[model samples]
Target: MRPETKEITTESLGVLETAALLRELTAGLIASSDFDAALAQLARTSRDAIPGVSWCGVTVLRAGEPASVATSDVHRSDLDRLQYGADGPAMTAIRQREMILAEDLRRETRWPRWTRRALALGVHGVLSAPVDIDDQVIGSINLYSGRPGVLTASRQLTAMLLAEHAGLLLAAVRDRARQSELAGELDETLAGGEVIGQAIGVIMTQRRCSAQDALQVLRSASAALSLPLREVSERLVGSAARPRG
Candidate 1:
């Protein structure tokens, strides 16, 4: 017989235990370098922290497209993909930005296609909590169980907490990536400006003309050659540095 779902109260998970869980999750998130890695850590940690959860998966919007970023087991990727192929809890949770729960796949009438496939995969209960990364980006942290009624109220709370932390960590990762990109552009701009100044100085000396005239000459050459101003400046500077031959 299938074991009855355990309905443990939230009180069973005390303040101290919750604090320890937060610490562990913080360490896991800090060790991750990107959104995928951080969410994968949460999936793995949730499976161990929650009593009834047999596996976990995470789905998010990548470049405005839905993607399954993490799963506890390799085989579970099919289960998440099946949900994407049709309307299911993970997508529903993300769209509505709310929690979605199916107490038992056998009795679930909301998503027929997803339910049928989940039942075949031996997943009976599912709970999805939305992760709010930003105004434009949202996702879901999904918990799966092998028996009906295993997704208790307390476990749902735990899943919600984990999703919240995932959102914050993912936002940090995005911010870091944006910062790095901006820094690269800034460095390129400074280097290009320096080279352009050198080229202008060389032109001024060669033509015995004003700085403005030197810049105009460089611009005219750039337009005639159909090259970027930076490229033209780099070529001119390189040619000027060469010894007479």
Candidate 2:
């Protein structure tokens, strides 16, 4: 479902200013090449754009199994550790794939394991919005406040909008990561081809055989060992390079 953006209210001039800033921030994030830098910018943008939020950060699904706080102004490492330990609201929102509001950590025992720790950190309240892409929950944007009830209805709406922007940026980062992996594979393939070709040349020269004969030798070695043709080629090349003295 699309985030509800109607609850955000401000003076007309303030609203106009915020809209311009949001546009600039979103554009900057979309253009950033570094994922961590982009996430940091997003957190900063949310904290600045939304009123009453003392801290803002993101928690992303790590390997599709657990949530890890990705970025934030608050005690990011501590919160991440709690989520990684499976004892925080970030994980709860990710597991449920829904919005969560903890109005007061001191009184809330819903996440008993995490509440005491958060209260100890002086975080009075928190609002977590799940970051989902195409129905798959990938992460969340958590806004923490030292003051309780800081995430009122209006602020929650603003936070959701910020989270939606973050979700899009995260999806783009994932796509880029996949593309980088494919590019690495392609480079490996090209390097393997070159190595195999040089090995074939070595075989042909050392044995005074034709190209077809050298290929047949490689194929025979592969078949005998049930190894790949490339592996056979590599071995042949290595043997030919050893000193005969």
Candidate 3:
């Protein structure tokens, strides 16, 4: 049978259910520290949160090429990899930016090789929901079931909702990580400035010279030692702390 592709509508989901999904996705973000962790959590969440989904995998465009980011179960990694480097539902969903469903892999005509192997792995049905990660990147949430007809329309709607929330949560996680990295850089810069200041103070006391002259001397020493100014400054500060025995 041919795979079904269509636009997802929210009419199948209730307000409280949607709210609960948002809460679950937010929890996934809070419980994660990086992109990979967040994606792994998302895969697990989708597998458990959506009814009839036995396995879940997340695939995203990395450097303009699709890469499998996470799978709900470690055993599903091989199954997910089967879709990569070949034409399959996940790629179709991502490329078309729509949901793709194969109600029965046995009768599925498209991607015969993939469906055949998927059946060997005990997957009888599949659902792929596209997620917009950012303006530049897109992804898909892939769900697999052990029996046919398990991936119903209502379940597809739920998976779609999960994908929407996951996109937002992942973007937040990425931004927060960027902010933390910048903060660490700022802290290092401030600490380095303090060391340079202390080194200049030591040079001023020893030679009775201006701060600018001390800095120039430090730079000259850095050149002679073939080391960075910051390293030279730290070494100078360390040596000045030792007693002149």
Candidate 4:
């Protein structure tokens, strides 16, 4: 869903200008290398692009992991307390996979603790949008304001757009990281198999031994050298693959 856009400046930006900025923002996110960088970028973007946003931060909730908060300008001690939790608007957005807003904290009864704390910190309202990094991770972008109703419909849409951009970039990074990890595992597995096979070939040719016997030889070498069998086999196979003058 496309969220509405808002201009933070005194002179509001036009629709075309806003669209261009959003395109540029997503392009930047596509190029970001890590989620941390993306989070920082999104936080900064929200603070600049959305109207009535005093503070911004990201809540990351990866499956099977603890929640973490990446604050852009939520440095106030009271605001910092919201970094980890499942009850706030940010968490609600992630859980519901939709936009959640607290127009006035004093009237908010859904999350009593968060509302009380936020009210104490001079934050009268908030807008949160789900930032799903694929199905395994849940996240949200939260916009905090000092005035009730400051995050109006337009501003909330802008914040939602920012959150979605963040989700897109984070999902890409998460997928890429997982792919790299899988590649590493595959490479290791293939290398081990190749080394063991090559060692067997060398033993068969030089020692006239069967594959099982060659494997036993490798085991013996590993025990004597205090190395893993794969390491010993890798060394043996590597030396054989090299040409000696």
The digit string of per-residue lDDT tens for model 4 on 113-181 reads 777778877889888888767878877888888899787666656666666666777888777777776
Candidates by lDDT, descending order: 3, 1, 4, 2
Which residue pairs overlap in candidate 2's backbone? none
- Write down the lDDT that model 3 would get: 0.79
Residue 58 lDDT, candidate 1, scale 0-100: 78
Score each candidate by Cα lDDT: 0.79, 0.69, 0.79, 0.73
In candidate 3, stretches whose alpha carbon ends up further than 4 angstroms from where it belongs are 1-18, 31-33, 64-68, 82-85, 194-245
Q: Estimate each model's TM-score.
A: 0.69, 0.66, 0.69, 0.65
Which regions of candidate 2 are displaced past 4 Å?
Answer: 1-21, 64-67, 74-76, 82-85, 134-137, 184-193, 196-245
Question: Per-residue lDDT of 1-245 in model 1, one digit per residue for the tens?
Answer: 33332323434445556667677877887645566677788788777777788998878776566674688987766666644424888888887888898887898898888778788888999999999887667778889999999896766767777788778887877677677766764665467898988998999999999998987898788779998778999999999999998
Using TM-score as the measure, name the better of candidate 2 and candidate 3. Answer: 3
Please identify which of the two predictions, 1 or 2, would achieve the higher lDDT against the true structure. Answer: 1
TM-score, candidate 4, is: 0.65
Q: State, as a TM-score between 0 and 1, how close model 2 is to the true structure.
A: 0.66
Per-residue lDDT tens digits of candidate 3, residues 45-89?
777776688999888775566575689877657655634415788
lDDT of 2: 0.69
Q: Local error of candidate 2 at 198, Å?
A: 6.5
After superposition on all C-alphas, the RMSD of every candidate to the true structure, in Å, is 8.8, 8.9, 9.4, 9.3
| Candidate 2 C-alpha lDDT tens digits along 9-99 | 4356556756765686778676565666766776777666666777777766656564445555556456645543266777777788777
